[model samples]
Target: MNEQSLNLDSQKVDETFFTVKLPEQVGLSDQLWHLSKLYTLGIALSYTYVHTPFKCPRSYNVGYFETVIEKSKSILNKFTSINSSSTDKLIEFIGLDKHELNISDQQFELCNIVEINIDEILKDDKINSTSDLKKCIEYFGLYSKEKIYSFVTKGIYKFESKIEQIVRSANLDDSTIKKLKLPEKYWKAKEKFSGKFSIDNSKVKITLHIRKGDRTCINLNGKLVSVFASSIKVIDSTDYRDELKQSLMDTTKAYNLIQEIFNKYGEEYFSVQVLSDGYQRTFFTIIWAMVRGKIKLNLNDLKQLHKTKKALSKEFNDFLRFSNISLVVGESKQNLFQSIHAIVCADILIITSGGFAYWVHNFFRKSNQPSLIINLNSCDNKVVNKISKFL
Candidate 1:
């Protein structure tokens, strides 16, 4: 049947109905970001749902978009029919057995399906530059010509000027948005948190999130950290890699910088927290620099050193022992949600440039605290400023 046969207005159906199929392997934060955008678009257009290969983990405790769609069963059954083998593979990939499949009747099959390439959508000139919702919808072919009468009757064309406001003030009454705003478990766990480091609520916690690994563009360079060292006066040259490396390795400089920050912020009211991959030598070196003279050797520290002895480089293993600091060691081993929670709770935050950091600064952070952002990506300062305004 066609859209005209649907009799949308009499049935109280919105002008259009569609399901957006999200590509697989997108990161968690990125998936949420896209979903947030789609949520706004869905409200502006008609009933919308998302079909994603990845399910939101139970730890997040948020319902996926499909759970809220009125006719999710119909949508999924049709989707499965269209891409049968691929759907089976995806179900298997997520470890869902055949018994867990929830396919239902296609009695309410009135929706169109759109495979959304997030990158392409973002790159679309109409979407990127204009605030015209209808124009965007037409550009993306997200409507049924058979439902032309409903579009006109529903005054969809009249919403062009108010698109920006509609998008900005979109009612985020969904469970996903609510759960993200106040993650109860994340905060509850903070009381008895037992991670690589403990949260000290007594002091002004300053979290430094240094992005490393495959994302090299936004990696926190040694030179940037050396700027805090008052005793080190290395000339600013085009390439200060050698000088920066030496300065970081120099424990005295790290101690001097830490002392300066402690004195300035009040030793009793200041604490430093770091979130990054633990396997990097720079991570060990930086930790050693901060705690070298402050913390005395302990038995637990010895045990931790032995545990991570083989994982760390010889020099960094020695550094950890000399500094009396212990760290959870592995590639990308840090818990992202925990780090995000720490960032939100921090009185002051130091972050490197990236989409993840930008989103945290914009949507998740509720406090109007001071932040020192290292822009390594030559990113638009205006974009950063705009994100900060939202916080």
Candidate 2:
């Protein structure tokens, strides 16, 4: 749309254009990571990248889906372009007949369509490391040049050990990181909360993510109070419920270990904030049960004016009245970015096992302040190994 702002090189008259077509079932975080990969590859190969906006069903913020895509394109527009032309137009521009186009081909020579199959690549035992994966991509001539070295460098590796690099490099000054900034309201929330707590340099400020929503209700744990059970798909399996309950208990044990670690540091005091979708009763129940009254609830006054129902139970109300834990309830709603903002602000983060958590961890891998992160699902030996250093 803004040609000059796109920063396209005028000297390069002839350019290769490519579009990244992600799988239909991809989540929002995975979608962004794949786009980041495409952006990196485009820069390395001097290819013009086209973005095709995809649907995200799990997203709570309806506007955020479009906002991120547009913001990312504007920030990283050197190779990014919108889908302004039709498939017929693209075929015509490539000088290929519609009938001759083989949809099953791995790579369309004229119009490059990168079909990302991450699961397939990860299955290979030989491709265990990022270096190995990079070589494989190069070997397949995905973005290989005669003399140009591998664009997926060690710089990205230092930030995250994962194979998929979320950015072009680990340099935070780059536009890749800048593109991740959410709307102004989310930032304001962060700024407002940042001043309320006195974050100790010696102590760790931990933020644990306990994901409870329609999607994770069955797989992770059954809701303590099924307020929206009618909306959720009911799976009729006692074994499934048992497995999920066990997993949740394991996570609860991890939380207890974290509490003990803080206790050993000197005091058992630590700031706990629960970022939930809305005023979900299960979130309150889980936190009250696990945290044992070491928590603060900061409710937005403006948004609080709109909520009609008081979702708290009589027991929770009684606990709040006598306990030292703070409770400030209001009508304000929650969004996905707000949760992410909380993650970014935390010094120690314990997240659920899912794509969303992994994406947030990777995005802020090389944070300004050091953080101790534990994935509840994978925190047996791995988390215990990291715990000795902090203790």
Worst 10-residue lDDT window for candidate 1 reads 147-156
Each model's lDDT: 0.39, 0.41
lDDT of 2 by residue, 98-154 (tens): 222133333332343333344455557675544555555545555632212212221
Q: What's the residue-level lDDT of 369 in candidate 1?
A: 49
Give candidate 1's TM-score: 0.44
Question: What's the lDDT for residue 251 in model 2?
Answer: 34
TM-score for each of the candidates: 0.44, 0.45
- Each prediction's RMSD to truth: 14.7, 14.7
Q: Which stretches in model 2 have alpha-carbon errors above 4 Å? A: 1-10, 14-27, 48-57, 61-203, 215-241, 247-251, 278-335, 365-368, 380-391
Q: How well is each residue in 247-314 modelled by candidate 1, as lDDT tens digits?
A: 33333333333344554444555555555443343333334544555323345444554444344333
